[model samples]
Target: MIFWAIFGYLLGSVPFGLVITRALGLGDLRQIGSGNIGATNVLRTGNKGAALATLLLDSGKGAIAVLLARHFGGETAAEMAGAAAFLGHCFPIWLRFKGGKGVATFLGTLIALCWPVGLIACATWAVTAAVTRISSLSALLAAALAPAFAWGLGRPDIAAAAAFMAVLIVIRHHANIRRLLAGTEPRIGRK
Candidate 1:
């Protein structure tokens, strides 16, 4: 379990957004909009391809960690790995502990752990984003709903893991939450 968790953390710490942006010569992602190394901020770079790649890679890290841990270890190891992966994305040591908001990794981990709940969460995010055109709010709504969905699906362990990741995601979105309440949070495509 410990080994899987550490491996997950290390894998999750890869910082795909930063890597992708740099590799594409988009400039330092940390100096871009919101100074965040996440898919949404990557999108702000005006490169849809880079943003899509970042999203997939970030999510893939979490999914891969859970899948590998589950295969080599067990369900508990999978859970630990998933949670650790989320944490690593949010607080990667490579970036001085400042990292992404964990939305993509959270969804990926949840999907790998429980596909049904993950699908529901993803759908909730899509619907919310369509209605509000706000990525942060959409992610928050999805994270908020994932635990409940897991619980309803009779997966208490998954619910607990989802709740943990959801709380951290919400914490990371503190500025966005404040802006949202003040009606100042930017829309998805707005510059």
Candidate 2:
């Protein structure tokens, strides 16, 4: 279990978004708007391909870690590994304790627990983003809803995991929450 947790963390700590963006000559994504190192920030670089790749790779790492833990350990170990992956993405040592907001990582974890719930969460994000044009709001709402969705699906363990992920997401977005309330939060594709 310890080995799985450590391996998961190491896998999650990889800042693929920053690495890919920099490799593409975009420089540090952290220096850009919002200072976030996620697919959204990659999108800000006007490179849709890079943004998509970042999203896929980031989420893939989380899913792979959890799946490997499940294969090697068990359900409990997989859960622990999933949480480790999320934390690693949030406070990656390689990135000076700075990293993405963990949305993609959360999705990956959910997929590992239950693919249907993951699909629903992804749909929620896409619909919310399309309607509101606010990626942060979309993420916030999806994260908030994940636990309830998991419960409705009769997965208490997954519900608990989603609840924990939601809390982390909210905490990570404390600043964005303030900006949102103040009507100062920037919309997607708006500089």
Candidate 3:
């Protein structure tokens, strides 16, 4: 379990956003919007392709981490690995511990732990993003609601992990939250 959990962290710390953006000649993602290596910031680079790829790859890492751990250990290990992966995304050591907001990875971890919760969180994000056009708010809403969905769906293990991930994700968005409260947060499609 420990080995798998560590492996999950290593996998999650890949920094897909930075890799994709650099590979596509988009320059250093850390100097871009919000200085985050997530898909939302990747979109700020004016490259939807890179953003989408980042989102998929980032989320894929979380899902793959949890799934791989579960296969080798059990639900407990899966939950532990999921949380670790989320943390890895938020504070990847490779980037001098500066990393992403972990929204995509959070969704991926939730989905791997409990699909119903993941689907509901995704739906929540979609609706929020559609209505408000604010990506950070959408992500926050999804993160806040994921734990409840996990609990309601009888996945207490996942609920616990979701709770932990939710808190860290919200913390990662402190600047966005401030911008949101100040009515200065950027909307989707705007740089």
Clashing pairs in 1: none
lDDT of each: 0.95, 0.91, 0.90
Error of 3 at 131 (Å): 0.2
Cα error of candidate 3 at position 70, Å: 0.9
Q: Residue-wise lDDT of candidate 1 within 102-169, one digit each (tens)?
A: 99999999999999999999999989999999999999999999999999999999999999999999
What is the per-residue lDDT of model 3 for residues 1-191, given as tens digits with 9 covering 90 to 100? 78877888888899999999999999999899778899998999999988999999999899999998889898888888888888889888898788888999999988898888998999999999999999999999999998898899898877888899999989988989999999999999887
TM-score of each: 0.99, 0.97, 0.98
Which regions of candidate 1 deviate over 4 angstroms?
none
Which candidate would rank higher by lDDT, 1 or 2?
Answer: 1
State which candidate has the highest TM-score. 1
Stretches > 4 Å off in candidate 2: none
Instruction: For each of the candidates, give the backbone clash count.
Output: 0, 0, 0
lDDT of 1 at 125: 94
lDDT of 1: 0.95
